[model samples]
Every structure is written in C-alpha cells, then in structure tokens.
Target: MKEYKISLPICENDIDTLQAGDYVYLTGTVYTARDAAHLRMYEAAGRGEDLPFDIKGSVIYYLGPSPAREGQVIGSAGPTTSGRMDKYTPTLLDMGLKAMIGKGRRSPEVIESMKKNGAVYFAAVGGAGALLSKCIKSAEVIAYDDLGTEAIRKLYVEDLPVITVIDREGNNLYDSV
Candidate 1:
C-alpha cells in the first residue's frame, strides 16, 4: 500500500496522489465531526452563519468515541459507518473540504462531488478499536463540547492506517474489490 503523511488543509496534490486501496498514515491535525456536528454545520450554513472551522482540505473523521481512559488521549477510537454523513458531505465538499475519513459506502452524490472537487474518502478499519486508538497521540474537543462524544475534536495522530475508498477520479474500492 502506498503511504502518505500529510498536514491538514490537504492540498489538491494530496487528493490527486491517492487512489482506491492506497494506505494512509495520517499525522498532524485531523478533526472528528460526526452526524450531529455535520447537521449543525449545514444548519448554520442555511442561516448564513460562518462555519467554525475552515472547510478547505479538511479531513473529517466519522466517529463518536468513548471517553478517554485516564492518561490516554482517546479511547478505542474507530471509524463509524460513512453512510450517515452522506447528506452533509457534498455541501462540505463544495465548501472546499478535500478529504473525508470514515468507513463503508457513501451516497452517489458524495462520490460525484469527490470526483468533481478533487477530494478523497478514506476508510479506517471498523471494530478495530484497540488498534485504531493506538494511533491517536492526543485529542481535544474543538467545538460542540456539549455534544459529548459527538463533539468535533482536533486529534494528533501517527500512522493512522486507512484505505482509500473513493478516489478523485470516482473509483470506489468497494466496487473494485
């Protein structure tokens, strides 16, 4: 598997280099933004409010992790199903987001947006909690703290293994594999 470790605000070059089945060992900052947070973002957009975080080239991880164990940065963090965020994704992509990190299939609209916008979707292993959690070096909630585990968090990670699910060219790993 081809490996890449990129900083946030991942550029078009980062998206272009990824293909279905490539492995990514993400480092630097990544944000956790699941269903609730996504809904709020869209709602804010509809109301003409500015988004809390920059959407450009931001990688959103679909997760609602359990509270971290004492002395640990996270607890058993792993990818949730990607389908739940399908509705919000295309809108975010249009806002300049470059990549998404989750698991399982996404809607066709999301895939099309990824292709047109030069974005990519990554799939982390589902149910591999212990393995996945090991990659997180630190984490802190950046927004929506009252949403508890669903809050958006900035995470520092290393070698956080993921498989490319959708490429910029519209290829899907699920269909090909």
Candidate 2:
C-alpha cells in the first residue's frame, strides 16, 4: 500500500493514482452527511433543485458529531456505516462527488458507480472519534441543522487520516482481507 497526502475538492487526476489499501491524509474541505442528509440531498437532486453545497469535486464524510465541549472545535466525530447510504451513493457519484469517508462494505452497484465516475472511498477508523475530531480545524452546520448531529456540516480539516477502502477502479481493500 502507498501513502499520499491530498487536498480536498479532489480532482480525477488525484484519485487516479490511488489504490485500495493506500493511506491518505486529507487536508481541505469535507462535508459531513449521514443517512438523513443523504436522503435529503438525493431527493433534492431528483427534483432538479440546487443542493446546499456544490456536488462537483466534493468529498462527503458520513459523520454525526456530538456537541463540542469548551474550547473544542468539534466533539467526537466518527464515521457511520456506509451501507446505509448505498441507495443514494450512485446518484451522488454521478453528480460529481469525488469521494466518501465511512466504514464497512459498500454495495456492488455503488462500487461500479465509483469505477464509472472515477471516485474513491476512504475509511476512517471506527471508534476513534476523539482522535479524529482533532483533525477538523473548523466546523459549522451548512444545512439541515434541525437534525442536530446529523446536520450537514462544512468542515475544514487538516491531515485527516483515512484508508482507501475502494479505489476508482472498483478495487476493494475489504475483498482481500
């Protein structure tokens, strides 16, 4: 496996060099979205409505952070099960979403969409919420704030660690393990 340092609003060239099992340290913007947020986005797209954020070249992390404590930018922010968003995944990929960060396996259809779209999938280590939050430099709810922790947050992150669970070519690290 290789290790790479990449910035967000990722382009196809940046993702082309990656392989499943490669380690990545991402710096730049990433939007947080869980199941509720995904459903909303998907529905919005279906209606040909504008999304809260631009979908092109964006990375979406499936996270629901807890309320922050004093002096903290964010609270424990960990990945949620990715499979829950499988139904919405393909459409998002088609809409120009560059990558996704979460845990667990993805459906075959989603993997195929990733291959077709030249996107990648990264996995944040589960149960490492506190450690992960340290990478987030700033966070603010951009939409769906009523969902609280499930809100879509615009976050600025630096050196946020993740592994390439599935690369653009439909290569899956989980398959070999």
Candidate 3:
C-alpha cells in the first residue's frame, strides 16, 4: 500500500499526490464533526453566520464515539456511516472543504461535488474501534459540547490509517472494489 503523511488544510500538492486506493496516515490537527454538527454548520451558513471553524482544506471526520476510558485519549473512535452526512456534504464542499474522512459510500451529489471542487473522500476501516482509537494522541472538544459525541472536537493524531475512497478526479475505489 502506498503511504502518505499530511497535516490538515491539505494543499493541492497533498491532494494531487493521492489517488484512489492510496493509503494515508494523517497527522496533525483534524476537526471532528458529525450529523448534528453538520446540520448546525449548514444552518449557520444559511443564516450568513460564520462557521465555528474554517472549512478551507479542512478534513471532517464523521464519528460519534463512546467516552474515552481512563488514561486514554479517546474511545472506540471509528467512522460512522458516511451516508448520514450526504445531505450536508455538498454545501460544505461549496464552502471550501477539501477533504472528508469517513466510511462507506457517499451519494452521487457528494461525489460530483468532490470532483467539482477538487476535494477527496477517505475511508477508515469500519468497526476497527480499538485499532482506530490508538492513533489518536490527543482529543479535546472544541464546539457544541452539549451534543456529546456529536460535538466538534480537535483531534491530534499520528499515523491515522485511511484509504482514498474518492479522488478529486471522480475516481471511486468502492465501485472498482
């Protein structure tokens, strides 16, 4: 498997180097946002309200994990179904999101948006809770604390394994798989 290590707000060089099926070990800061957070973000965008965080080149991980165990940075943090975020994805992409990390297939509209905006979709292993959680070195909630697991969090990770599911060129590994 081909491997890459990148920081967030990934640039064109990072996106261009990746292709469908490439394995990635993302480091640096990534913001976590799920269905609730996505909804709030879309709503804010509709109301002309500034987002809680900048969306440019941001990688949003779709997850709602169990509380971290003692002495652990995070708990059972794995990708939730990507479909849940489909409705909100295009809007975010239009708003300048460059990368999204989740699992499973995304809708055609989302795929189209990725192609149109030079964005990429990545897939983490499904149900690999224990394995996935170990990659997170630090975790702290940055927004929507009341939403619990659905809240936005800033995660500092190292070698977080993922596969390129959809490339900016509109290649989808899922269909070929």
Candidate 4:
C-alpha cells in the first residue's frame, strides 16, 4: 500500500493517481450526506432539477454528524455504513462525483461505475468520530435541515485521514482480504 496527501475538489487527474489500499489525507472542502439526503438528491436528478451542490470533482462523506459540543465547529463526525447508500451511489458517480469517504464495502455496480467514471472509494476509520471531527475546520447545513443530523453539510477539512478501498480501475481492498 501507499500513502498520499490530496486536496479536495479532486479532479480526474487526481483520481487517476490513487490505488486501492493507499492511505490518503484529504484537505479542503467536502460535503456530508447520508441516506435521506442522497435519496433527495437522486430524486432531484430524476426530475432533471439541479442538485444543491455541483457534482463535478466533488468528494462526499457518508455521514450524519451529531450536534457539536460547546465551542466546536462540529460534533462527532465520522463515516456511516456505506452499503446504506449503495443504491444511490452509482448514479452520483455517473453524475461526476469524484470520490466518496465512508466505511465498509460497496456493491458491484458501484465499483463498476467508479471505474467507468474514474472515481474512487475511501474508508475512514469507523468509530473514530471524535478524532475525525478534529480535522474538520467548519461545518454548515446546506440542505435538508429538517432531517436534522441527516442534513447535507459542507465541511472544510485539513488532513482528514482515509484509506482508498476502491480505485478507478475497479480494484477493491476487501476483495484482496
């Protein structure tokens, strides 16, 4: 495995450089959305409506952060189970999403879409919300506030840790294990 430090708004050129099992420390803006937010975005796509955020070169974290404690930018922000978003992921990839940060495995179709679109899948350490939250510099709800913690949020991070679980070539870390 290898390690890399990447900046967000990650592009096709960035995607081309990663391989499964490589460690990544991401710095910049990334968005957070869980199942509910994803479904809303997918439905918006179906309606030919614009999404809340631009799709191209964006990295999304599958998370529903808890309320922040006093004087904190965010709460225990960590990865959610990725499979929960599996049904909607490929569509986002097809729409130009460049990378995803979450925990666990993705479905075959999602992997295929990642390859076809030159996207990447990453795994943040599960159960490490507090540690992960330290990397996040700011957080704001961008959509679906009624969903509370499940609302879509834009986060600015510096050196957020992750491991590439699936590369653009369809290589899967779980398959190797």
Q: Write the per-residue lDDT of candidate 1 for residues 65-120, one digit (tens) a residue.
A: 98887888898899999899999889899988888889899899999988888899
Predict model 2's lDDT versus the native: 0.95
Candidate 2, 34-63: lDDT as tens digits: 999999999999999988899899999999
**Which residue pairs clash in candidate 3?**
none
Per-model clash counts, in order, read 0, 0, 0, 0
TM-score of each: 0.95, 0.98, 0.96, 0.98
Poorly placed runs, candidate 4 (over 4 Å)? none
Q: Give the TM-score of candidate 3.
A: 0.96
**Which lDDT value does model 3 have at 125?**
94
Query: On residues 1-177, what C-alpha lDDT tens digit does candidate 4 reach at each position?
Result: 788999888867778999999999999999999999999999999899999999888999999988998999999998999999999988898899999999998999899898898899999999999999999999999889999999989999999999999999999999999
- Global CA lDDT computed for model 4: 0.93
- The parts of candidate 1 lying over 4 Å away from their true place are none
Full candidate order by lDDT, most accurate first: 2, 4, 3, 1
| Least accurate 10 contiguous residues by lDDT in model 2 | 7-16
- Between candidates 1 and 4, the one scoring higher on TM-score is 4
